[model samples]
Target: MESTREPAAPIAELDEDAAQLAALGYDYDTTFKRDMTFWGNVALGFTYLSPVVAVYTMFSVSLGQAGPPMFWSLAIAGLGQFFVALVFGEIVSNYPVAGGVYPWSRRLWGRKWAWMNGWVYIVAMFATIASVSYGAGPFLGTLFDAEAGVNTTVVCALVMLALALFFNLSGTRILNTAAMVGLICELGGAVVVGAWLLITARQHDVSVLFDAFGAGDGKSYFIAFSAAALIGIFQYYGFEACGDVAEEIKNPGRQIPKAMRWTIYIGGFAAMFIAFALILAVPNYEAVVADFNAGSTNDPLTMVLISAFGPIGYKFVVAIVLISFLSCLISLQAAVSRLTYSMSRDGILPFSKKLVRVNERTGVPSTALILAAVVPASIILLSLLLPDALVTIISFSSVGIYIAFQMVVLAALRARILGWKPAGSFRLRGWAFPVNILALAWGIIGITAIAWPRTPEAPWYVNYIVLLTALGVLGVGALYMWLKKPYLVGSAPSGDATSQINTIAARPREQVSR
Candidate 1:
């Protein structure tokens, strides 16, 4: 007869004796690895492209109508994200885990509040996945313009979500591998394209960057650019993804915190450089604007490339754009799954047990992956049934994610200002704290600006959807608080170590019955 015993985990040991001693009948033993390197952490942080997102959102809206100082808006948003990253770094230093912001908020606040944070965090997370998929679908379809079919867009969205889910469920090793590859592709692609643009730019066109005079329309540059800044926030969202994997990170208390700091500066600067280079390299601002206004989904960057470097350069930009979208998709998947797992482990949602399950072979939160993919897939399918439904939902997603981000930053600031200091960790000395406080303020301002009604002519449905999504998130938080009351109020240790123990116990079991 074939052996019934499964192979043991190479990097971990089963604490069967201890389990027996405690009379616990948990399925799996304590077995996992967390040795991610500095570079790996960098890869994880860089996989979320601020520049691509910044460009996409900036061009999508009428930011130029408001003013030409759009870059300043990006600068403001980047600065805001930078401060939030510092606050996050402090928290990660002391209690690094995959939960990232929500868990940190919980630790600083309390279990009940953490569950509320998780409700908002997870809802907003899946909403983000839907938004990205929705946003990318239109762009990608535009790339295929004349031949783009409705069925094609739907199919592509589903496929991308499925593949992302596979990468997520394949476990930590595959996730890290994908992160490294995606990061290289994204960083290298940005640098190469930016370099090409700079090398070939005529000095006259480059002069446009340093002009102090605003585009001087009726709109103030700050407000118009603030619209663009909304897009800028996209680029930095994934940098903290490494923090989500903190428990799986080697020496996370030190390395994860350092990774967060490094990610903020590097990701922020790189994104700014890309934006500057692309703007400078564009030979024809009129052409770039015309293409964007014409709704060409080939990427505004591709339009810039074609205008500057001809057909070949345009093709190169096209490839880079696709890679950028792919990297964003990968980073989003990892973040959503890890967050779902974290929330589940805390019993903040339904299917808590299932969502927290780690596959024996993969050591991934498989059920969480399924949930992430399914939710987005359903949203996409619903889009098919309702023509402009996905668009509204995508917009709602931005509102949700931005609000959640604001809360996390505010919570971090509250902790710091209330005399909570990071213990034995990487403190951002030398104006970092002051900068962080400013960033928090800017974050709040930006979110409020984006949420505000920009035009009287703007559709009424947008207002309704945004309002409804906010209420829904809050409602879920209330529901979770009621259901998970015991877990939050039980006075158990609520940090990485305890969570890790629960995660270990939740794994698949293969015991020696004798």
Candidate 2:
């Protein structure tokens, strides 16, 4: 008996999407399978912005630093990130290629500009992968009843990283499936857990959200609040991961922008909801702060769960949180690998030929995926040598990504100044300039906030770690660019949109999920 199968897509709609790619100076017959759907694309970014991982990791720091008042910072930082996301939406809508910032920068400005921007983004993403897996180590340690020390953490993180790479290199089907599972578990788990905590274990009233609890000096609370806002700043990113695999999504211009925006909306809401519930349920904020101030390894939310639901219950929640973390790891690796592939395909990175080769059966850049895992794995192992490794990596990941984002925003604003309107299905129209400017403002403040010296008492390098690491990464890249000039060597044409992006006219089954 013969089997039935739906068409991959309507001929004309496929033609229009292909035409846009061709006009952008790439072959339309891409080896990458257009296997991602609108929801799958959304899931990709949403899981990457995992609420469970963000809230569980940072809620304790914010609460410990600025007391309950830090709850409002989620909205503040999220607004800034949303502005940046809007700017990205405009760009990706017009140029929905792989490597979110790099390709867009290449077209908007030129190769050198894109190269440095891509370099910053690449480092940030790898740091994020390492930091996320490292963060998960503690929870995994808790779940397994292992000793709480650097050795256990590094081992757990490495195990998780290997598992993530396995899923990532498996194929697009497995990758998207892992992301969707992560989305369901994370968002669904957050709602259920938040509501349960709010209903059964509410120890403080909602008004507690206004109290700073003498976080800063008696003079002003600005410094402490700014430091606490890192929680939101860290949480709001990962939405840009949507555009990192544009070539793998059908009707990418339209799908990717919506996916990006939704990642911010839903991810922000989930983070805020969980944070609010955890804040109100804290049985003793003063003691939690004391423990955090004393440099304890245990997180406040974990303590709260143990109080509300005994050790066994806390262990159960740890299992759920571990799943969320693993899911996040999978998405981060996928996004970073796609970026490496995009950069290598343009001959911008070293070993371009190896990284650029897409696996014939999997339709993924398998070697690039391995490269992504390898770099972060080394970074994760730093948990052994540097006691403050996680914090430094977290700061770099947030600040580095924010800087890269603003670079793109600046490029877009510059392009607008030179009279290039967004040419895809989505456009900001008259609001384009205004939104672009707002995004730049937000990015600047954010980079400063995350990179600012929160730990002056610590060693100098540790205190100014974000700035130092970011500058160091860029310094090396600049020297390489000047000497090697890799950008001048690529035969693949740079993406300068010669005409308006070809719109994908309505076609049957265009929105079908693969």
Candidate 3:
């Protein structure tokens, strides 16, 4: 007698007919031409830095005690990210799709465990959208020096979300152009600011850059800096947004990997400069810290600029900060919509095809874009009632992205280690194995460090949120397996839809526990 369990879908090279079918709900018409030049790619790098978010996180937390170690923490996180970026560079070259990590991991590990990768990524994206959009309001409000318009920020985020949705739904051309513009307006300014800091630091008391001052937490200098690294690291993580737009990029297998590697190195270095400049310019360290902690409107960079280069410099930094925030808002919206489109196309989400439908003329994911706007809007509304919830949500969301990164990195490493190389349009050579292993170790350490309580000065809830979010992802993945498995069986709508979904749709189940 044969056992009753259904056989899994066989992994095979997709032929023409199957490929066409998979492309149906994939918003192919909206696909942008692969016209991205190296400069456009560089602009994409700056967009990920999103200086506004970086400045906001550092000033708010660093004010408490961390000071310049904040910049050092960023460097440490960048080292870990280097490995993760390498892993991404390799996998994305082979499997470049909007779904990104989840699909790559599942394929590497076998479908039995793949769902775990996709589900965690989906939840993580949702949380990230919530957190970043929420944080946007305060940063903008700080620049304006006004009470944050709960409605205004929410509305603004929603509008930004809508614009991103439309652009993505419209086509790759628009998204690429917008991303390029964002890189210029925001990232260019950040590089300048970072440069200014480095140039001016030598003149001021340069020791502040080396000062291991504590914010009264009593943690070792290394630990404090590591915690600070979390804040800085947040700025760099979204560079993988390039991977999510793979379908729109021409020869994505080559370009996506190239984009990821370049973005990390360039963006990471750029952030380091901006951070150092901000820290060093503020020779009155206590006052800078005080202003940062006192309220949301503390513009430390502005203050530092005034001290170093006078009022003219302050105005320039302020202009750059505003532009940077605007660019970030745009990029965040783009990331959210594409992620949604990728998930919906996979039938892992409801109305998969319809939700991800692209407007042929505009080359955007119309429905998914609309829905993405709703999430940020809702988050903005939540901020009205709960002002403090913004950063907490963003911090929580960062953990989810890290987990997704880890899973993707592990899957890529496993494949390379197990002699399972799939030829793609682009490739990473030689050190893939060693670099990936190092990346995995760094990711584990960073995740564990972020999960632990960094300061007793803060409430216990910070650590609890991290734990709960982790458990929540685990429980949600299990729940999908138990309740939604039937809907996802081979050759069914979900199964077929899975082919059209982004590469990161289904994660391998085993990896979650690991």
Candidate 4:
């Protein structure tokens, strides 16, 4: 049968967009230009996740902890995060606000809860940018045949940060273009390298993937699996970047949710495929593990690449890896800046007025972009002071992001319990209850796995840094909120809860129509 439904008029769509923004306490004139298309949003999420980069960075660590069998944990983590993404999809479809969790939480719960969510998320994102840039150091060094020492790595990271900032400042068009190019390189590189290694140089037996090989401190296989799951947990999260830029996304209520889920689906497959190929291509898995245990150079993945593709091929692959890394940094900075801009627009953060100001020429949040680069660059300096700064920062980022994510999931569950129903096109319908519960449970497990002290023999600060940092962030955010309660409540547009809801409800029926 021929369809009779007519496409929504452009003016009607604009009115709907404006009404939705107003409901969230925003005006069209003050928000980001809705220039990000569906593919751009997908590219942003994919590049942020950066399967090839993430898998390469953490592959050796997972193998050292649980041998090749750790690949199974990636599958498990992907399943759990699938549900989490669904919950996030539903929220973004209805709200579709920038700042991802912060604004979502504010609408679901209250300002105080949203403030803390942003606090942890902002800290985690800064640490994430630092960690990702630092991880790129080795690959950059290999690509250029430079020494991958601490000073060299730090310098490389700074340079990458500068490039990311330049792209970010150039506006969404250039940034999205770079992201699309990165997506092609990332996926194409993964397929080429993975297929080459798997077909030409597989060294391990198929059954090796199920074998723990006694890697887990003489503990049970489950314990070893838990230890290895950290890589997957961290790798699966960059999909939320789609939501972080919701305001800039066209038809965000529908497209952003689909983009978020597709980010995970594609990213998870790419990560696993590359990891499996690398595992199969290892010439001497035992020696590689032993080198890792002995705290030797942390370039086992590079060695594997060299063995598989020879020197020239290795250099080419390293260049691809560098591209992935740079793209990841760019996506990270974009997400962080948007989040910062969203919070600032709500007058939650210090210097909100300045930070909320977008550059008219570039259509980018200039102050927020600068702040994003400065915070991560400053955090990167910790590499000079700490012996294991890279690992510490990675752990901090993983745990903090998981905590912030779980908070939103918990809020969703709370809203559901209070009879709050989602009106988004991507809603789970009756399935929301179970999905939210499962996602929350999975989040808690993921958080525990990341925070648990893997090595009791390590120094107190090293062993407990993730937990300590999380606590400290929460404490500081709570104190800030408490001290500035009056001002915070008065300054924000959404501060008047009753009026905000009433205003939204009073919007014209056509404007509020889905």
Candidate 5:
């Protein structure tokens, strides 16, 4: 008996998408399976941002630095990031290419700029994976009732990385399903936990949200507030996961932009709500701050959860956090692999041919996935070797990502000034100039804030590590470009529109699937 199944959908739509891409001078073949729908794309962004995971990871640091006032940073960062997202949406709608910033920069500016953008972005993404995995270590330790030491955290982080790689290599179907599951778990966990904490609140005064009780170490409240803003700055990123996987998304020009904006709006609200709930729930804010200042290994969030829900319930929340962490890792790895594959496909990176190869059976970028995993794992191992360097290394995650992002935003602004109008479904029209300028300004401030030396009292090396690391990464990337000149010069669209159209229309349809 022969089994009956509908024939796979014809490649007509895929071919059309390829044509649209070619019109923008991006003539690459569609190697990715367009299995991601609108919601799936949004899920990818949400899981990558992973508010619960981010808040859980940074709560102690932010609370210790700025007390309850740190929660307000979310609103500030969210507004700033919305401007950035607006620019990103316009660009991605016009150039819905894989490797979000890299390819977009290539079309808007030039190859050299795009190559450097990708270089910074790829490094930042690797750091993010390591940081997020290490962040999850405490929760994992809590769940297992294991000691939260350096060695244990390193091991846990490595395990998380390995699991994320497995899911990434499993192909888009499984990965998307896992992302959707993560989105549900993330939303449910935030709402349920937040509502519970709010209902049983210790009722700290509203003024507490503006008080910088922990501002000291020769740092004024303004500096402390800037430091606290790092929490929101870091949390608001990763929404570009939607744009990074644009090739895999259906109706990307229309859907990807919406997904990106929605990711920011929704993720921001969730992050703020959870932060507010946790801040209000703190039975004794000063005590938690003192514990953090005393270098306590226990997470401040753990104390709040224990107070609100007891040991068993706290464990349950830990489990949810673990899920959030795992999903975030998975999303990060997926986005990084696509970015790697995109750069490799354009011959911008070394070992381009090998890195661009996709597994025909699974439609996955196997080599890129492995590369993404190995680099971050090495970073993690490096941190283990020099445990004190962990903070400096992790600092690269947020700063690096923002730098790459702002680079693209700058490129888009330059293009707009030069009359490079968006040719997609989304456009800002009259509002483009002001929004782009604001986004650029905000990004500059953000990069400075994140890289600024928070602890002036500490050793000079420790204080300047973030700035030094960012400079070192860019310097190396610039050196690489100068030495190899791997940029694809003269790749921009030059021929007449009619001729280009004729060329694309004449190309064999089978080429779309190549």
Candidate 6:
């Protein structure tokens, strides 16, 4: 199967893709050129789920909180998220709509249900971009030999955000190219550094994983482990980004589903392997844990990389990490913008018409792309107000994303209970219902694990930021839905779609197909 399913795809194949869209009640969007190949779709998801960026930014948090044993939380998280990914595979296989979560939920449950899903997902994505940008700031500071401060980090974050926006706005091809590059850097860097360190600089024994670094040695450690699992929770998402640009993929029906699964398979492996190798290679494990416990800003990852790769090689690795972050930013921006464009196309947003407009020359959603960048940039400014703003934003983002994902899984389950069947080629033979149930269960568990308050010593707001942010987004969306009534009785498309679904108590089939 060729990755690139060009417009010259067999008439039957092209028709199949278009027919699925038609079944979903949308015409093929000519505004988005179907330029993304299969691997390019995977690249979008992979880069968005960049292992290097995730592991580098989060490794310290996990290690600091729960020591080397925290590494296994990723394995647990991966296994759990695989179930969510499987459910999503079935959903995307059937829906294959742009904006992944938002559009799929819209058709599955209905309009107001989807409005909240898109709102929370979009806000979380912007926070994600800001988080990644801010996380990459210290690396940028290292690369430039600049003092680590608010001004320097903000400048660096803004610069990276601008560059990501510029490349995303340039065109889909360039965006996909950079995404592939990002995938390469993250996967290859993780493997090369992981293997190199494990071979040449291995310091800790396998028993270290069982040691909680004096935090606790009993079942009480479960609490710390769950708190540290945020890394895995955050790392496993962005696979849905493949289906986010469904209209941009040439053979989205088949390819997007495959891409989503591969992203989890490959991306999850890389994330875990890197975390394992980093933990094993820590030269002074006791002292490293001590500094982290002492509230020192010492980066355990930098120390390990410098010890293994030396100063020059450390810089080389930093460059690769920087590229991975920038690439992740680009993919995130692209996915978020496409989601915005998709929702706007349904006339759901404030400036729906302008936001939905695609640039003729580039086939990019220009206004939506700009909005994506602008929102994240505004988020970056908030980092200056809060100490450890990156961590706060990242925590909210991880949980918000979980909340959003679970909403989609819930919608799919509801539609299934209403007699919806898998229509796409990819489906879990007799396992769809069971798998969907497990996925929903896993998602709820993930949301609880990540959103649980770990900062009891901090202010109440900071302690509960993750839950607060999620509730805030949902609250605002619900209020807007009540006040504006965007899905009112006579409104176009969504309101009509909601009516059709509401009537189908026995069979949740689309009106178009009916």
Clashing pairs in 6: none
lDDT by residue for model 3 over 1-514, one digit each (tens)?
A: 1111122222233332223223322322323234555556545545755655676555546544467656677777777787777777666665556656655665566553556766666666666666665555544554556565566566555544455455545455665676777776666776776676668643356567676553434447666565656676577686677776665555566666778777777677667666666676665656555554455565555556667667666656665665555556556556656666665555566566676666555555666666766765665566666545655666666777788788777776666666655454454567767888898898788777667676466667654767677888779778867887723643322222223243322222122112
Name the candidate that leads on lDDT.
Answer: 2
Candidate 2 positional error at 334, Å = 0.8
TM-score of each: 0.80, 0.93, 0.80, 0.93, 0.92, 0.92
Error of 5 at 150 (Å): 0.6
Tell me model 6's lDDT, rounded to 2 decimals: 0.81
- Candidate 5 C-alpha error for residue 492, in Å: 6.8
TM-score of 6: 0.92
Q: Which model is ahead, 1 or 6, in terms of TM-score?
A: 6
**Candidate 1 residue pairs in backbone clash:** 27-509, 34-250, 49-235, 50-235, 98-244
Residue 361 shift from truth in candidate 1, angstroms:
0.8
Candidate 1: residue 170 lDDT (0-100): 67
Q: lDDT of all predictions, in order shown? A: 0.61, 0.82, 0.60, 0.81, 0.81, 0.81
After superposition, the stretches of candidate 6 with alpha carbons farther than 4 Å from their true spots are: 1-16, 216-219, 489-514
Q: Write the per-residue lDDT of candidate 2 for residues 124-146, one digit (tens) a residue.
A: 99999999999999888988889
The runs of at least 3 residues in candidate 1 whose Cα sits more than 4 Å from the true structure, single-residue gaps closed, are: 1-31, 53-67, 138-146, 149-151, 201-207, 210-221, 283-300, 308-313, 383-395, 416-419, 428-436, 461-468, 479-514
Q: Across residues 346-454, which tens digit of lDDT does each residue of candidate 5 receive?
A: 7778997788787765677888899988998898888866645445555688899999999999988887777675656778889999999999999999999999887
What total of clashing residue pairs does each candidate reach?
5, 0, 25, 0, 0, 0
Better of 1 and 4 by TM-score: 4
Which stretches of candidate 2 lie above 4 Å from their native place? Answer: 1-14, 296-298, 493-514
Clashes of 3: 25
Model 3 TM-score is 0.80
Residue-by-residue lDDT tens digits, candidate 4, 1-514 = 1111123334335556655755555555433677888988998999998888678878888888788888888898899989999999988887777789888888777788888988899999999999999888877776777885898888888888889999999988888888898898998998899899898878887888976665765556677678778788778888899999887876677898899988988888888889889888877667766766688775667778888889998888888988899899999999989898888767778887788778876778878888888988998887799887777788889899999999999988887777666766678998999999999999999989988877767888777888998899999888988988622543334323222353342233344755
